[model samples]
Target: MAVQEHLIESQDRAAMIDPFVQLAFLNDAIDDLTAANLDLLDAEWFARYARSVDELTARLDAISIEARHRGHDRHCGFFSTKAWIKHHVQLTGSDAHGRIQTMRMFDLLPTWAAAARSGEVGVAQTRLMARVAANPRVHVGLLKCVESLLVDAIVLPYDEFERRIRDFQRSADQTGAETQARLNHAARDAMMRQKADGSWILWATFGSLQGAQVNEVLAHFIQAEWETDWAEARNRCGDDATLSDLQRSEPQRRADAAAAVFLAAASAPGDRRAPLPTLNIVIDDTTAEVIVSGGRLDAARYNKMICHTQNGDPIDCSEAAAIALWGHIRRVVRDASGVVIDMGRRSRLFTGAARQAVLLLSDRCLWPGCDRPNRNCEADHSLGWKAHGNTVPWNGGTMCRAHNRLKETGNFSARRQANGSWTIHDNDGEPIG
Candidate 1:
């Protein structure tokens, strides 16, 4: 019986080796799957379908790589593999180029390719890995840690996984990262053009750090516009007001807010010193020493460093060092676990310096699925004041007015974790993702 089963398996494998057989099997499978009633499918079925699709995509990518290796494009009268793919696959130019690039990256990183083929990682995660692998300065070093990064890709959210990869690149090639930052800064430009219609077009480019600053200021102005719209809607329609009742569309509001920003800047008083925007830049001790002394650090030491904006956007350590020389810097110390060890004030309400510290630390509201910016959020006690929570930075969390009110009603709660992050729980004490 074992010999018969082995013979059958070998026969099946050999049959699949023929391209026509594979195509017939795929066509039949897709037709059967698509014939199913979509309303009858369960969550588990959808998940399994997605995984199968990803595995098939990986296999197709592998075939594309093999075709490129065999010079099939040249044989087909095409100059480049990308051009042939664009034509044959009916994909956009950019999509075809991206697909070709990703396939090439898979040839270089076998572990990632294996994981992709097995459906252990999805296409989005693999695309991010391909992007990192394309960087020459970090490509060789990144290959050494493919397994570890694969774990992150499988377990973490896409955004966090992207951050981890970027952090690795920065640590592996700090000089290259710094040079790129300098190039971006040098290339920054802004232009205003008047069209035939009486309206004007504004365009600008900024490096990561400077763009973050611009984004921060724009967020405040946008929030102000939102507040006005919300107030007007509530006043007109009371609690029945919906998003459609808003006075302006989102794009219109953003354009108005941009104009408001320019008007505010132009009208500012020249005699008095305007308050500069506060940007939180986190750096560890060793990296700070290296940046301050203009010295080089080993990759291991660089890996230990933490240098990024408050919103987790990594910037060049050298740029942070230069800013520290002329900017008013506030030192907030944290312990090994990233819990703030210093800077606490005694008060019932989160006020003044304490409030500023809370805003500086928080990028958005603590409530799950809430992306209300910290500037528009109110600082609240995770352990309520009535419950004897201390009025310290560690005890406080940021939440929007609506969510804060909901928490106050005792249907929800928040906890400040050891790493200075917040976890919100439902009325049943289940943690919300």
Candidate 2:
């Protein structure tokens, strides 16, 4: 009798507490947090605080989903849920649509939704997952492997996680991937328009393979300009040279490179046509075998297959195999550590095939968060030539010119690990990433 009476009393108290009151309490807590001194907080505290915020955001999203289902927007005299959100939250139309789409994704992915509500997953990761889930061809497969994908989302870096999702999409729906590739090729377009100021603006889009080819030629010309800038900066500023000392800004160099390309094309001999740029497509044995056999492999094997351009853009397996037939294919051998063990002969400096091998080993500059393409980077000696570092691919890593100069200053250091990844450190001996 006493237990029943206590339960009734608890139910009455719960019924008395309004949602607006709960929100008011939440606002008060946020005010306290905003007033707290951040200087006294540590990294762990900040991480925990971010997770708490994520949890709250997830809860709000859940409430929004319920409101949409209940036709709350109609009751509030709004045409749609998105319009209601846009008017109330001061968000743009696109942003409001994105919120609605995310709500739908959460509805489809209950496991992920629960994890989000618990603060175990982040907004960025959830957004990426939602994007993959939106793909009609791979949606079912994504749902089947949500548990494993969730683990990857938690553990891998954002860039790698994105790549992983792409791999999954390609492997799970090869036909869809190839069809999309063809559509992209069909949609290629370019236009140049002169502005009122007498300057011109060029806008263009190309399929992945064609874009890579165009970028390769541009990068070669840009590299020549980079060399000139380095020479001029050395002559003028000597040891204290910095990126600001360069003769041309990056955009200016790109424009110059474009002009050079046009002039070179106009001067071509005999046929009056420039030769096609060579593209380097890398494919692992597994992917090549699948292409040769004309049969799909299990998802696990397909996910592990490596097929991409040197610029790190994933290519459809069938498309890469077709390109391999006409292009010169060079074999690259790597050791168990994923280090390029053999490409060609070594020399005093990274040149010829050795230099090419270094570029092939990396898609971008070794510096964390630096997205400069490999062709625009210098092959740096990790241990320094004076320190007896060999001129082999194993001893070399790619770095942009500015970062190379920074490393030479001794204020920063970088080491290439056995896995062919770089570990960068600051002057204080703290790892940069």
Best-fitting candidate, measured by TM-score?
1
Model 2, TM vs. native: 0.79
TM-score (C-alpha) between model 1 and the true structure: 0.82
Write down the TM-score of every candidate.
0.82, 0.79
Candidate 2 local Cα displacement, residue 192, angstroms = 2.0
**lDDT of each residue in 1-433, candidate 2, tens digit only:** 9999999999999999898988899889889988988778698787677767776776665555445534536866887878887887788998777777777778888888787666576677777777777777777677777788788777666776777778887888888888888998899999999999999998889886777677778888988888888889999999688899997999998899988988987777877543653677777767676776887744554345677777677767777776676554333433234455454234567877677877877778888878888877888787777777787777788998878888888678888876456889888878775
lDDT comparing candidate 2 with the true structure: 0.75
